[model samples]
Target: MLIILLLVVFMIGTFFGFMFIKNTIAHWLVGGISFLLLAGSVTMLTMHIRDNWGMKEVTTSTTHQIYTAGDKSAPYGMMIKAEIGKNTDNYVFVYRNNEKSEKADTNFKPDEKHISEAVKKSATYKLVDDTKATVTTKTTRCVWSSDFYKLLFSVGGEQNELVKQNSVVSVPKDTWLVLTQDQVKKLSQEAPAMQKQMEAQLKADPQKAAQLAALQKSNPTEYAKMQVKQIKQLLGITE
Candidate 1:
């Protein structure tokens, strides 16, 4: 409709030009209507572009499972690692989406060529101890709300935009380890001391040692995970 209106105005303006050249009254009337249409079109276009006239921001959420990124054992159990950037405040988390998944997923898109700045501005990560089965991500962004207004300002308008996105991951309490790269490296360097401390702690408590022995015999994988979680807590490295 808006496009047709603009086209109609163009035809009227052309007719007005010829009439004006002939010095007639019809040209003045046509010229007035043409001026109004042109002014209105410009104003609507400007408003739609500058103020998002026909759109509203909406937040949508989705949830999915995630698993440990790397080996859980160099220090103790099951682990999820978030690698911290050397020069930036951002952290890169790697995780498998499900038990059957062959590859891990990162926070950014695999096809994205560059995402350092975009992640800093639009993404946030949180770790929670809720024992939930999945991680939830909420994305807030603008979308067209009025079909008529959208048609009116279809040209040169920003149809969609990302405002922000937040990901909240839930893990089992006391059984999951979330650590940074720096901490992982430091823990690796102090592994010998950590092992001695862990051995001493287990020997001094016969009940705890027996419980661990029973758990290891029943579930070796869970035992390794528990050991990792225990070491992480022992070193006070929770990020």
Candidate 2:
């Protein structure tokens, strides 16, 4: 868009320059070509942005799900599962904690892996947009042991693998998967059931539940409060 706008501005300046010099023939030819080029460029840019970014609004009900694993004391802690859709193409999940905000794009393969890791870390996930592919890729760095992990994941058409201290992974178009609104609705509806199942599993294993409860109790109140704030934002309940 910026490029097209610049081109249009340049063409207009050239047209006026020729007109000021009283070059009628030059003005007519250059002006005509400029006009045509401007029109074509604007159309192409508009179409490209629209095709990649335009997404339909969803009007489906949503339900939240919380899960508690049976082996809470295990290295892998309790898992919170929320079903947004079974057949949706793209899904955006955002996480916020302590004035820090993190967004995850599930529209592509890298986003899937990214969100999966976030959820495992007990970060709050919010569905921002549930529509078609908009951006080419999403990138983010991971924080590990209080030090920022120097790796970036780029999700788009071609999937890339990073192995450097600071690496980048690009996902290919064929690997991009977008979910539909109906699928999201279905997942929302089933969330409560999944939660119930997890709760039952916890009940069957009191020791595990106790361990998880202890962990939660030990978590810093500040961090928990931050997560709550993020959750509210994801639900569109907070500004």
Candidate 3:
């Protein structure tokens, strides 16, 4: 609306100042003002086209089933590979929306920097977008705030800008784990010993081992959760 109004005023000023007015100074003054208005209109139009005006930040939330990064067919329990930094709190989460999927989906690539968090919640995974701004936030762009703003610009095809995408993944806290890089290294080095120890514990209790074997065949998901619980106990990892 402002752009159109400026254009209309420019047209009127041009017509009266050049075609109707008789005075020289008045004619040049009006023409100059009109040209300034026209320039302002064109500059504003360009900015709107470039999506650098009239935008707002919006947040949305979603949920998906999460899995650990490992074998796709039988992934470990939900875990976050934390990237330790002086001030950054970043997490890498692997997930799969489909229960039968053979591959896991990740929120960010392994090399990319992002911030994330894990919260204690239900068995189902919940992904909530946070509004906090961090150093890793993406570049800002603008979109039409509403239909009214689009009408004012006369260009309604604009998409919202992404500032940051911080995911807060909620998982069953009791079954999930967050391990740092050093801790992960230690776990990898001691994996053989831990596995043998776990096997020993199961063998010591024949009924428990049989029940786990049955559970694995009947309900693989529950079986995975049970395995994670046992590993946490062996490592003395608490919720």
Candidate with top lDDT is 1
Per-model root-mean-square deviation over C-alphas: 5.0, 18.6, 8.5
TM-score, cand. 3: 0.53
Candidates 1 and 2 compared by TM-score, better number: 1
Query: Per-residue alpha-carbon lDDT of model 3 for 1-239, expressed as tens digits?
Result: 56778688887887788777778999888877787877877777777657456566665545444555444444345444544344445555455545567775554443333222122111212322221111122234345687766676644434654444454555554344455556556667787897788699999999988987888889875776676676666566765
What is the lDDT, from 0 to 100, of the residue 177 in candidate 2? 19
Q: List the residue pairs that clash in candidate 1.
A: 76-227, 76-228, 77-225, 77-228, 78-225
Q: How many residue pairs clash per model?
A: 5, 20, 1
TM-score of model number 2: 0.26
Per-model TM against the reference = 0.68, 0.26, 0.53
Tens-place lDDT digits, model 2, residues 24-101? 787766776776777765665565345422222222222322222212222211112233345432233321111221
lDDT by residue (80-133, candidate 1, tens digit) is 345344544344565666655566567543224546326633333454544433
Candidate 2 Cα outliers beyond 4 Å, as residue runs? 1-5, 14-18, 53-68, 72-239
Best by TM-score: 1
lDDT assessment of candidate 3: 0.57
lDDT ranking from best to worst? 1, 3, 2
- State how far residue 223 of model 2 sits from its true place (Å): 40
